[model samples]
Target: MVVRQTVLVCVLAVLAYVGLWALFSGDETETPAAPDAMFLTDYSKATTGSCVKFNGPGENDLGLTVVDCKGSRAALKIGTVLPNTSGECPRGDYKVLRDTRHNAALCLLPNAEPGDCFEIDTEDIQRSVVSKFDCAAPRVNVQVVDVAKESCPEEAELGVPYEDLTLCLRRVR
Candidate 1:
């Protein structure tokens, strides 16, 4: 009777071990999932056509600022939402380039108009660009659109004195 009892206990232990192993083990083909990516600002606060100032173009860590288009450091007016604010805004002349890294969205003035294909190199377009200028003057010419298609023009020996670049399209001479 003792021998039978011992044998029964051993079998039960082995079965229990096997059951636990099966329950804990995952499929060999399964892989751990990666965490979701995070952005700096909660863009949900913004609306379409609202004027906004995005701090950083890359990684968007600095966050966003809603500014007056007239007096503030307004970069772009929110247009048809690719990624931008969602609020009332003045009718914009052209769309500003989307800088995902900065989380920036600024538009040119209604009076100012973009010219040829403009290739924006910097993220701080508000600081880098001017209001409007003649295209012949050598500043970068731009045609703001909902989506950016054209590439930045190749730079030749030609270099301007280089001051504030026009955020609004500067018409060429």
Candidate 2:
């Protein structure tokens, strides 16, 4: 199933690239026009499980770069949030990374197992096309733990974070 999804994503990526290429002229320096309303969705408003570039933490107008999970720079995937957010992120793990004043929640891709540290890249990141190659590289390791109903299991260690609902975690040094 994963293989099929990977293949599908690859095919879709190729198609999207071809479409984008056709949208541009021969000038490599020419910037593509801003996306139309039909294509204005950003990472903050993307669907759950959608892979997105981890552009450090901020709530500025600099929109996120959404991409295929198979692609690189997919440091995080969108997670659940409170309802009625008007497409903005809610109070959650992603909100912490993004700090205050923004609505977004994300978890390290692949839902790290208990006591496991996930590696991610956090340097020289900016708005750009993120590729699968980026996922092959990482800069730091952080631990993740899944929480339920805002509470950890009795056996789970203490932490002070939350993501959507079933997940609150602390980054292990």
Candidate 3:
């Protein structure tokens, strides 16, 4: 009987040690923090004429240039943002779809897809007014241009641009 009790005690002690080590040693993997939200601004509100331009932080300290005008939609050669790796699958990892527009291009990634709803991060939206315009002034009718993918050669194509790629901007009261 004593031998049985001694063996049981030993087993229990070992289990306890393992439990304590797991709790204190931080053996569990720590989760990564979520990437910050991104935002968009209305091109109309920033510029007076038909065209509006903006830039942002991207991969390799390179920036992205967005040009929106009456009938033209082009994305200039800007830097890429570091791909998000916080989740099991990273967001923002993208491939260029094509290059045809002057200083403009298209890209494709899982995060940016058609029908994927995302909240805009107002704080991330930065602006430089190349031309000043009053918000209340007559708003120009701008049509977002959809570049043709066929113009790009098969090898140069990245992926189809999201159908709804327009930056949805809301006016602040």
Candidate 4:
């Protein structure tokens, strides 16, 4: 019985190896071509100044899509890109996205602009994603007066500090 079992196992192993070899040693199948540059969605290659729509932390999906800076879908700008093992983004304010599989980190800046309005997320201030809206809109509670300026004007009710500058905001509520 032992001899029969050993012979059966050896036969099965030989069959498995032959099957795997036959599956891989094929010239009939053509290798797939590389994807086009425009269709590539890898955000790890994004550089400073590139605008992106990111899926922030705590969300089920985590990735980014590069978009036009002037477009409404652009939520953040790449302040800088670094390795996942690198230090934090330069102090002030920034949303950091680290992709462990890719070994990359993206320092993102809010894509806020003058005349744009936003709704603040109090629960997680650092993860508060900004989206542009009309100042007169009902949900628009904060309006930007100036960005990256020498200083926020005295008339501005709130001054949100950011990298190298301050965003002068006025209460819309």
User: Could you say which candidate leads in TM-score?
Assistant: 4
User: Per-residue lDDT of 23-45 in model 3, one digit per residue for the tens?
Assistant: 88955777876433212232112
Where in model 3 is the C-alpha error above 4 Å? 28-173
Candidate order (lDDT): 4, 2, 1, 3
Q: Each candidate: what lDDT? A: 0.42, 0.45, 0.31, 0.70
Worst 10 residues of 2 by lDDT: 122-131
Tens digit per residue, CA lDDT, model 1, 36-88? 22222545434565555555553143554555555333534455343453333
**How many residue pairs clash in model 4?**
0
Model 4 lDDT-worst window of ten: 34-43
- Please say which candidate is ahead in lDDT: 1 or 2: 2
lDDT value for candidate 3? 0.31
Lowest lDDT sum, 10 consecutive residues, model 1, at 156-165
- Give residue 145's lDDT in candidate 4 (0 to 100): 83
TM-score ranking, best first: 4, 2, 1, 3
lDDT of 4 by residue, 1-173 (tens): 99999999999999999999998896787888753212214546777887776555422347566777787667567787776636577765677777777777877766778888777653344677655566777877788788855788877887777667787888888
Best by lDDT: 4
Residue pairs with clashing backbones, model 3:
58-80, 58-81, 59-80, 59-81, 75-104, 76-103, 97-158
lDDT score of residue 119 within candidate 3 = 28
